[model samples]
Target: MKQANSGALVVFGLVLIAGLGGALLARGALYLGMHEGDTLHLLDMALRMGLHGQWPHLDFMTPIGILAIAPIAGLVAMGLGIGTAILWAQVLVALVLLLPLVRMAGSRFGGLWSYVMLGYGVVLCLALVHGLANPAPSVSMHYNRWAWAIVYVVLPLALLPDRGRARPYLDGALIGLGVGALVLIKVTYAAALGPGILVALLVRREWRVLVVAVVAGCAVLAVMTALGGSGFWVAYLTDLLTVAQSETRPAPGGIDFADAVAGPANMPSSILALAVVVLLRMTGRKAEGLALLVLAPGLFYVTWQNFGNDPQWLLLLGAAVFALLRTDQPDSRHAGRLHDAMKIAGVAALALTASSAVNIAYSPIRHLFAEAGNTVPLLSALAGQDDIRVAEKRLYKVDAGVPLDGVGQPFAAYHDRADRKELSRLKGEVLPACELSTGYNAMFETIAADLEAQGHAGSAVLTADLLGSLWMFGDLKPLKGGAPWYYGGAPGLAAADLVVVPLCPTTEKSRATILAALEKSGWRFDELRRTDVYILLRPVRP
Candidate 1:
């Protein structure tokens, strides 16, 4: 027991040091204005909640979606601040999850279990960092990210042994609830964990747990339905069902689809493959764990693909691997030699785990190295304490308006009292309609055209990132500070007397044809702007 406590201490210490180090590094970058994706969105949601007393979707004033990054937001609200809280939240969730797995491994294999947890932690943190960089808005924003993090912790606890059987039912119920929370958080990994969840259920064969999970899941869904409205729930359910109908979808433009297999998923998928081995070699209930371990990833991979092999998904994946590799039979005479082999394997696993740690740790190290890149201007931008005149230039693009395209909200920072205050006061759910009336920028012309074709011309258009396509192509009149479409200020499409739309003809012939079309429409064809993107306008009063 003393030794076990010692081992736990060592692991705990390492985790703390590593987590703090990682947080400090990230905080520095954040402080220096090195903002990543979802950073803005998450902060926006928090500011809306904090400054405005809103609860994610309940705060309809801000045309943003739900505060899916709730855990982070809650931490931030509690005064832990933003970036540090987010990083620590990820680490803490990972540690809570590792507890059960370590216990299970120790129950069967002893000290080696710690090593396995350690290794898995490394892999998960590494993968999480990758996702952290350009966190998909839903995935990283508010409660959504936290919910996924909880899923990472909860699912592993469920699969681990119920040590003393105290609350196998509770554990199972918690797993279900966590999973249910995840499903509601965002449909991001709903598809990826199918095989994994199945494997866990089949392995545990605890129907009560499943019932608890179902009930918990239903309760969460019911609450969301009640709060978000039946129509919203219907749409949410429909979107989930639609995505599930297809096993794999095309990767977004820049994201790499291939990374799905190389990361932590390898662990779960490997276990599934090993389950075949276990079923063939082991006997009775003893073999059930291994078999289920193997089965889960296989089933999950087929059912949900978005997990895209993210490292965090490996929480159970690592446990399954350890389960499969564990030998149930006693060693007898070769026990000493076998112990040595186990020790060696444990060490090797720790080393492998260190690789994961390094992967996660690498971000901070890189950021440290990039520290030199922080100039007076960047630091000023980050501190939110820059010289007003210089800071104004960096924060508000003279050319780009308050809300840039693709970056859905207006005001680079939600601190833009004039805009965000009104946005946060909204009474109910708000979905920013992406339509042509927002204005024509090079970045969203295709999207704008689609909206127009769908008869949504007068709807507001917002993009996640203004690709600077609008400025190069369109004759869009400047709105307030920057280009028209970029600011958070809602272009009162209802009130606009005139609006411009641009189309870029790549080839000379195509350009002539487009010009001809414009001429035929009886609208004047004027080459008012020149760039890679083209802009056209229509008089609203006409």
Candidate 2:
């Protein structure tokens, strides 16, 4: 018992060091400005709940689950400023994910190989940092990254050597918890893993495990619905069924079997899966090998559907390699051949993993190293600020008090506000800056001033862009039913007395549709203000 406890402590310490080191590296490489669409939306909802006692209504059109938002809410409730809370939460989650990988590696491969496995896991995670640290408004955002990590963690437990001897109930409960958590994050993504998990359990004849997983998954759904309110189910189901069917949302294209197997993102996983098959065959574990073969296609489909080029999917490959190599079987007549084959396969997978990490993280890593000297002062100056600002022609600042900047403003603003604090301190801040093509800050300032001039202060206002930023920055009331883009423009626009539009080509079609709707409803709109990039409109006497 004492020896086992000591071994566990040593493994924990090694994992802790590796996880923290990798997290720090990721922070340096990939951490920068917060993403507007998803990250900001989560932060906005959490802030609203914490600061003003408001719960996000189900009427809003978004795929983000309650679990995703809950962490930020809890952090903010603890009196941590939103910016600090978000950064710390992201770092902590990354570290927690490393724990299981470390344990599995230590148990299976003692000595330096345990640390090698840890390095492999970190590299896999580094590939994902691009999306997690600096997300975009695409369908696969941070939640998708979380789903990928969860799948990596859960899938390997089946291949662990001690599975047969483990407590049936404990093992079942753990599997159930993993699957349930994934479901709570995103059901569609979970769908990809659910079938494979069910099949694996069936192949193993682990009926207890299957039953526990189903019951736990259902309980999770029920609890989530209850916490999010009765309307949560209605809104969640409606959005899932409707928005997913909408033509405007980009859908994954079909891939030929060859491309699916050979795509950059899919290649490593394919190779690793093949390696697992060979390893299992040599060890005479036919049942496990067959179960893995069944799982390979589903996992590939999930990766292909999300983003085929992202190296993050390679983590699945790493998980497969770790699982197959870690078994505790004694040496056999085939052991020499098996060890040689495993080494070659493992080395190839690691090389690919490293290449992918470099491909995805190169820019951020370069930027971080290039500006390392200025990081401390920059962070000190901007700490606790979340409002977006531009400085030194090299960075776009967020008011969250973090002195981080990115390459450019990817979205437009609905109104221009001029009361921004122009500081000399920002003039020399060295960071990666985001160039704004259109004068969004100026446009937003003008809109805010114009709205106040028109006696529209405190009134619910609708916007086609920057809905959360506008409300939070201008101290305006939340638009009833949430942002039009999320809730469908017609309903949110109908509930507001004023609507702000940014007339970019990307928005032209949606703008035209909204205008036609207003005309059909016998509502006349007067243009309140116009800029090169934005136009503010108000309902006028019909």
For candidate 2, lDDT tens digit of each residue in 155-234? 65544444234444545555666677776666665777676677777877877767876776677777877777777777
Candidate 1 ranges beyond 4 A from true positions: 1-22, 25-67, 72-112, 115-128, 131-152, 163-165, 188-199, 238-249, 252-357, 361-372, 375-542
Q: Which portions of model 2 show Cα errors greater than 4 Å?
A: 1-39, 52-59, 91-128, 131-140, 163-165, 252-283, 305-313, 325-339, 355-446, 465-468, 483-491, 505-526, 539-542
Best by lDDT: 2
What is the alpha-carbon lDDT of model 2 when measured against the actual structure?
0.52
